[model samples]
Each structure stands twice: as structure tokens, then as C-alpha cells.
Target: MTYLEKWFDFNRRQKEIESLLEETIAQQSEQSLTLKEFYLLYYLDLAQEKSLRQIDLPDKLHLSPSAVSRMVARLEAKKLWST
Candidate 1:
């Protein structure tokens, strides 16, 4: 396959995977968190210190601090866990 074809295929597969993950999260989690929230949890899980700060999340997830704060707020609103 050519470069263009490869890029298109990769994008297609990424979208499909994203869709499947959304579906799985909806089915599995009672809280029904967004993909960003899941990534935040996963990143926190990987941290050696296990101490998550709002400032640290932006660097870990490549999101703005405000965006990370919003995700944390959403999760807290659901009462999923403390920040």
C-alpha cells in the first residue's frame, strides 16, 4: 500500500478502536466516564508516586490544565473517586 493508503487505513482503524472503546466503557462502567477521564485514570495508575496533581495531568495527557480540571470535575460529579 502507498503512504496515503496507509495513513487512511490507520485513521480508519483508530476511529473504529475509539468507537469500540466507547461502547465498552458504556457497557462496563456504571459511571460511564468519557475517554479523557479513562485516560486520566490510566495515567494516574501508571505514576510511580500515585500522587496526582492537576498541574501534572496536563503534561501526562497532553491536555490543558483547564481541560484536565474539567475532566476531574466530571468524574467527581459522578462520585467515581476523589481527585
Candidate 2:
């Protein structure tokens, strides 16, 4: 196959992988979380490797602190997250 063909094939496979992984996460969580919500939870887990702080989520998620707070509150309301 030509280089461009190979690149296209790789991109196609990568997208398929991403779709499958996303579906898996949704099934595993069994929570009706938006993609952003799922990503926030993933980031929180990643933060545990160092230190987690309320202020850090804005930078990590590229959202305002208030936005993160709102999302957290929603998750808490669903009993997905706790203080």
C-alpha cells in the first residue's frame, strides 16, 4: 500500500478504537455521564497519582472553576462522586 493509504488505514483504525473504548467506558460506568463528565472522572483518577485539588480541575479540563464545581455537584447528586 502507498504511504497515504497506510496513513488513512491507521486513522480509520484509531477512530474505531476510540469509539469502542468510549462505549466500553459508558458500559462499565453504567452512569449516564456525558463524555466531558467521564473525562473529568478520568482526570480525577489521574490526579490521585499526585495530589488532587479543586483548583486544578479547571486547568486540566480547560474549563472554569465554577464549571468544574457544577459538574462535580451533578456527579455527587447522582451518587457517582462524594465529598
RMSD of each: 1.7, 4.1
Predicted structure with the largest lDDT when compared to the true one: 1
Residue 21 of model 1, lDDT score? 93
Runs in model 1 with CA error above 4 Å? none
Candidate 2 has which clashing residue pairs, if any? none
> Mind giving the per-residue lDDT tens digits that candidate 1 earns over 1-83?
99999999999999999889988988999878777788888877777887677788898778998888888888888886585
Model 1, residue pairs in steric clash: none
Instruction: Put down candidate 2 lDDT per residue, 1-83, tens digits, no spaces.
Output: 99999999999999898688778877887677766688788877787564567787898888899999999899999997776
lDDT accuracy of residue 42 in candidate 1: 85
Q: Best TM-score goes to which candidate?
A: 1
lDDT of each: 0.83, 0.82
Clash totals, every prediction: 0, 0
Can you give the lDDT of residue 2 in candidate 2? 100
